[model samples]
Target: MSKQRSDEPEIEPFTGPAGGWGSVRSLAEVLPRERVAPDALRQLARQNKPDGFMCVSCAWPKPADHHPAEFCEEGAKATAWELTTLRTTPEFFREHTLTELRGWKDYDLEQHGRLTHPLRYDAESDRYVACSWEEAFDAIGASLRPLDPKSVVFYSSGRASLEASYLYALMARMYGNQNLPDSSNMCHESTSVGLKAAIGVPVGTTQLRDFEECDCILFFGQNVGSNAPRMLHDLRSARKRGVEILTFNPLKERGLERFTDPQNPIEMATGGETQISTQYHQVKAGGDIAAMMGIAKFLIEWDDAALSVGDPPVLDHAFIAQHTKDFESFADAVREANWADIERESGLARTALEETARVYARSEAVLGIYGMGLTQHVKGVENVRMLVNLLLMRGNIGKPGAGPTPVRGHSNVQGQRTVGITEKTELAPVEKLKELYGFDPPTEKGLDTIEACRGVIDGSVRAFVGLGGNFLRAAPDTDAMEAAWPRLDLSVQIATKLNRNHLFPGKVTYLLPCLGRIEEDVQASGPQAVSVEDSTSCIHGSRGKAKPASPHLLSEPRIVAEIAKRIAPANPRVDWDGWIADYAGIRDAIEATYPEMFRDFNARLFTPGGFWKGNKAAERIWQTPSGRAEFLAPGELNATGFADADGRFRLMTLRSNDQFNTTIYGYHDRFRGVKGTRDVLFINQADMAKAGVEEGQIVALESDAGDGTTRRREGLIVTPYDIPRGCLGAYYPEANVLLPVEHHAEQSHVPAAKSVPVRIRP
Candidate 1:
């Protein structure tokens, strides 16, 4: 391996708990630097409160017993980032041409702060000029009016509130299309597909309270410290309660290993942090399915041995026989699984697999938690199915402190889907919507994110309307997506801040500035409070307290309503003006759409901690075609096995601790000890030696997408890390270019971001 370079930033390892003084210091440093106003601090403090706005970060559930400071460091950064004094007014846009803005980095683009007014592209001048909301909406309606409704794509970000998402989805349906593609199609789509097949419900069965009672928690493919720091608190508490925490990841994340609670002053002052993972298994990229299958095989063998000897059975036979089907086939598949194949595929020893199974089998309450790592692969759906199989072996569902939970990325991603933002228009919600709204919604399936991009490229999709997100930057194949975006006849972005997507102007492009989550949303009637469902299915109200950055800014609900009125002026099925005036009316329509789950929506929202939209799986009520939980047999352990070629490595894209989704807070990854740069590729020392690369050596990555087209990203510094052999990790959005647009999960169509095959060049 190459020796460390003296000129590079320090790469020392961190061994503290995820939170503590480090988080406090980072928050303090960011607030002042961002020029956060004094009133903004009050706004930040109200985050996650009964009378306040929900954090716009990750979807970790808020605690029922609210803490004075319920937000995490990343949440604080997001709040400060949004509430910054910096503003991108018309003058700012006038100063920066579209060409100049396109050349800026993602962080620099957002750091200029919130957009203050509506802008329309001036092609002659190559700049975005301020335009009135009415003119912008009129342009959108004009472009959309000519195209077939099937050619229009309505995309949403996970940051959208439930009320706004419902109205947006309704607008699309009323216009005679169901091309509702949200961020979930890029992140948790695999989870929804897998879980729905396994347990007849697309949502997680576990609640936040389950963490308190869980005997064992198995985390796969997730780094709670960086992505969802608030989860560290729950994990730490569970650890103290004698709960065994086992983590499976390609790299040994510092937050998962140990974490200091920044909320605990004593821990911060004494430098005392709590140990998190009871055991950390370094599974290779895309090896989670194999690892889970291996664990299942071990559990089956142990159960057989116990039953043959007349000892108490290891499996929950009663629960299995009563609540599930296809078990015998699933069990046989696990039994027939070859140990040698599991070892080679999972990169773990037989002994380690057996030990993990033993721990799982002995535990009465087990909780399985996963993130994008498990869901961003070619076999992502099967990977999650394997996890559910393991959980089913122990009757983990419908029990306190036990179930499978896929920690979502965005705050209201799940909520958006819950409130009818989906491509599948034949779902129950569509039928209910037809009955309630007096409009016959589309029954045909529509384009997801990947399909939408493909449609744009093939000239099938002509108009694109984005409701809050940097779609171009967040998608795979950045160069291809950028090229395809300009092919659209019309493109509109309803956002609070400037992003790379805005720089790529279509034939007719408009930027409609909307109020951020922290800004007060005043409608015709009065101020409104929107609701968002957390990871655990708890629906809570989010009422913004901070003043709007600009008087021109409108609430997301109002923007969607206004667009709907312009696009479908002749439609008399719904009253857009009435709903926009009172958010309660919007909730009433949502209740009519999903009556069972959203009953008493207004009253429950005003409750102390809002309400839980109970999960059918949690209640042991299966809603599948089989009328029971199904144990589907998984395919081969390593379905997407890399070719037996030399110099090949599986690359998984990851987020830096300084970033949230595509928005960058800074260049430093404090948790990983990488300072001042995001261009580093994390690789194991053995892999570095095998590739003939030394530590801190610059390298190029060429995609092995098997499509006969070469895609390469250069200038990535290879840094020796604790990753498994033959595996590498790089920051996302930067490394996204290496992923081909066609590379994605088969069933869900979500991008296979975790298991990209690449060759490193020195």
Candidate 2:
């Protein structure tokens, strides 16, 4: 390991429960720093409320009877970030060269604040010059119109609303190809792929209210308090009702252990924490498949024992027989699974797995909740399938408080996919588009984030249009991506704030500032409400109540419509002007396309808490090829796409308590006892001594992919943490450099950020 560093971050054990006075103090500290502090507070009060805007942070569902202060700590920060009075106008760009801006950190770049005008890169000045929206649109249209549809990529972030996403996808399809890739490709794409094969639906089965009814909630690889603090309210309520909470992760997350409601006065005043997890197991990184199989194995063996004794069956045989298929193969796979391998891979004692199984067996209703930690693996899809298989053993699907829940990141990522922002043309509204507009949609497959990046590197994709996200930062293999990004012919970013991705301007680049979700979106008709679908497939309206950060800022829907009208062939049938004039027209179009799920879209959208699209899996109506729930088996315990090499450890990237996705709010990771710095690695004490690394030692990490390319991240301070012995943790974006671009899941192609084989070195 490298020599010890003198400038070390303040590290201490966090003994307090999550979301107590600590959370309040965090919000209090940040709220005052925002230039629009008073406005942000006003907006926070309206967040997630009826007729108000949705939180721009995580996609945790809001309850029907929303809290007076519906926003959480992170949500409040996101609001403040959006509502900041700071501006990055043409003057700001002129003052700082692209090269100078490129050297700045991601957080510092965004802190310069929201973009106030449209800008075009000027090669002579090495700066972005202010331009009229029409001029920018015309330039973009000219560049895009002549290109082959397959050569262009449209990237959408989860921050986009359903209206904007709908138009964005429609524009791409109308323009002829579906080179549509978004944030979902990185986070929960595995859940979509896995659940569709197993349970027929691509979303979580439980509604927001199901947490109250569930007998047991099993959490796998999710840090609810940090990612989506609002979910803690439900978890705390479930705990109070005597529901069992079991957690399996590489690190014993503070959120999954205990949480005190910041909203509840009694708990906040008393500092009383409601215990979250009944059992917390520190499973190995990328060992979710093995851990899941171990639980399933125990249940299967117990069922066999019951059957042999002529006693009551442990498995839900009646439900399984009537509602599932391929159970025998899955059961046989679990039966043949080696206990030694399970014990080794999962890093859990057999007794612990058995005890978890016992609790699962007795529970009348069980809910499996997970996040990117389970999905960002080489076998990410299989990892999800294994969890689904465990749930299927007890017929958890199609029942109240019983199903697999993939907690989603971003506000509207699922909604983006729902609105046809995907490379999969089959998921697009092919027939509807044909009927509505006189054009043939491209039948050929388009590119996802991974394929798109490769296309850029190889010179196939010449153009990139991003709708609200720090794409380059969120992507794996950061260095390669940065080097290859400038190769694109045309690049456009429609966003609220300036990010690192904007610094790497293309040959012909345009930065189009757009209104934030928290800002008012006024059209020709009046103030418009856009809809977004939550993790549970519940679609709701979010009408911005806060003032626009800039007068020049255009709504996303309007920008997308303008681009569509300019780039796409003129079609009298496609009423782009009308859609921008009244967002209800867009909703009507969506309803017409997806009639079943979005019937009376406009009417139901304004209803309190909006409407649930409803999952067929919850009703025991499987749409799978087998016409029933599936029991697919994951054959291998090693899902990192590589074997255990000598002196190599499994590393997973983490988000700090003060961060959300790639948007860094501050350096402190209070949950992990990290302060004033993010460049720290969390390793177990045993692993530290084993590797000859001590606390405060600045080390470097090199990928063990052996792909001839060196992927390394240096200047990391080692800190002993409560992680598994062979597992290590570090913050993302910084660690993203260590991941190879090609290293992704077998089926989903989602980046394997949760498990990367690496060596700590000097």
Candidate 3:
């Protein structure tokens, strides 16, 4: 390690295990500072409970038998962040001009806290002024009424409830608008697209109990420590039970290495930690497809050898012959694969691949778990399919303790998609929607996140309605998107807190404050409970017990319903007012729309751990065109073509331990040993040495997309760490500037955030 300067961020290895006193310390530090210490504590007590709200964090599933404290460190931050006492009232906005606020950091902007009233931008003064809800809604209606429906974008974030999302989707369709771009478009859209193409279902097949039963679990590119800390409990228990856990990522994430369960009193008392991963492989960034192919090749060759000797088959030939299609083509591709290329591209030796394959062959049951690391790539869709290919080789799908599980990021991202907040017209229940709402939903494909960005840039999109989320910050090419944001004729954001997205005022802009998920929402009908679908496809009810941040703040359903009533064409059959009055009515409509999946939705919602929306693939029922699981393979070994032959590094943007998505809770990343800054880069020690770059050396990175446009981020301090050679890591939203909006996954169109071809600016 090189010597650090005084101005450099505090950098050191975190020796402590994940989720011990570190989590406690973080919560302790954040709560009081946010001035929500008492109230947030009360809310945290009920988080993830049967009668309480779902955590406003990652979409990790809740166990049937819930722990007394089910929320994690990040979840606690989310709760405290929302339950903050700091208020961004009309007077607060009056003090800060839009131009001035636009120059502030994302963290500083949000520190002003929960939005108290509806606000409209005053271009004359270059500031936001307080406006009545009626004025805001009318302005939105006036702006939206004249625009072509196709010119409008209804962007929903994962934080919005299913009820709110349903209303938003319905409103968009009623107005003949098809664009329903959302947070999912940036993260797990590849998982949905790939899984649907391969298995007919778009969601993960494994239930929470599968963790207990699986003999082995393979994790890909997911950092469970920071992103989904609650998952540590399951992994710790699985480790204690002697299950083999294997991890593949550019960084050897501390969470996957070992975990000290905060919930385990004995472990907490003894300061004991459970060793998590049996083998942690630091694979090259964007090399998941290559690595997956190598594993499959080894397995196939082993099976071939066994078959030649007339030995018991290593592969599940019965499962393949009966339940799958196009196996021979996939096998042929694997057979034709060269071991040397696979080894070189994946940055793993052949021995390691063979050993991983041996583990898979011997295990009776295995769970294939992954996150955006596999999905946010040039070949993201192929990456997901390749993982599924490995699982299908051992008859993993449609079996207990087995299947591909995409660990989703947000609390209700999957639920938002389930409720029809999608750009894909086919995903919506059009016939059912028409019957319910008396309108023909738009059949044309809508703009996804990438297309939405393009639409805004080219001035095709006239309006942008955000249900929630920091759209510009979460998007690729952050600076470009932010610059292009003002091009929209109208911009409306329904959110809980003040963020930088709201500062980028459009020609006609409005900021509508909505109730946070952890705050009490008392509609006209009475107290209401919203539902969210977890990563496991379990639909559960979430009811807030804490006091509202402000009396003026409206519930998400009400805000969406009010906006719909104003802007959307009148539908006598649809009762938006009644649905807002009672969220149960919304649930009833959801059941009517997706009858097969949500039958008895309201009745089953409050059940201890909610009801499972069963996966068709898990039943060995493939809904593909051939009525069988399709074995798809990428055309080549260098799937992304982000080779290091030209000395360009594959950059994967990451979230700090203190951050959740674009929400910067603090400047500390406890796991990776970053502190007081988000602008540092993590490069391999050897790579840094070879490049003559010292630790804490300020450097610049520029995109090498060969598009003649320079996407660069400067003044980043290079920090040598345990990342793979030819790979570099930087925090997202900060590094998002380095990714071009056009560089995204094929077929899915999700931003290729995990693998961007870039070079260090000397």
- Candidate 2's C-alpha runs over 4 A off are 6-8
Q: What TM-score should be assigned to candidate 2?
A: 0.99
- Pairs clashing within candidate 2: none
The runs of at least 3 residues in candidate 1 whose Cα sits more than 4 Å from the true structure, single-residue gaps closed, are 1-10, 639-644
Cα lDDT tens digits for candidate 2, 1-762: 447765547887888889999888998887666677476777788899888888898999977899889988899889888888888889987799999998898889888788899899998899999999999999999999988888999999898999999899989988988989999998998998999999898888988878877999889999888999999889888998999998998887888888988888998888888999999999999888888888999999999999999999999999999999999998999999999999989999999999999999999999999998889999999999999988888888778898998899998999899989999976788878888777888878889989988888788999999998988999988888889989889999998888889999889999999999888888999998999988888898998878888899899999999999888888898899999999999999998889899999998996676698877899999989999998887879877777776699999999988999999888778888888888888999999898998998899999888888898898888889988878889899789999887889888889999999899988
Tens-digit lDDT string for candidate 3 (1-762): 244454747888889989898988998899887898476777788899888899998999987798988899999999989988999888986788988887798899888788888899999988888889999988899999989999999998898888888888888888887799998899999999999999999988999999988999999989999999999998988888999998898898889888888888898899999999998888888878888898899889889999999999998999999999888899999999998899888999988888888898899899999999899988889999998998888899988899999999989999999989998888988888888777888898988999999888888988999989999888888777888889889999988888878889889999999898888889888898999989999998999988898888898889888888887877788898889888999999998999988999988988887799888999999989999999996776655645565668898899889989989999889998888888798899898878778888878899998888888998788888888888899889889889998899988989998889998875
Compare the candidates by lDDT and give the number of the best one: 2
lDDT of each: 0.88, 0.89, 0.88
Residue 189 miss distance in model 3 (angstroms): 0.8
Ranking of all candidate structures by their lDDT, best first = 2, 3, 1
Residue 738, model 3, lDDT: 90
Q: lDDT for model 1, please.
A: 0.88
- Can you give the lDDT of residue 161 in candidate 2? 94
Q: TM-scores for all candidates? A: 0.98, 0.99, 0.98
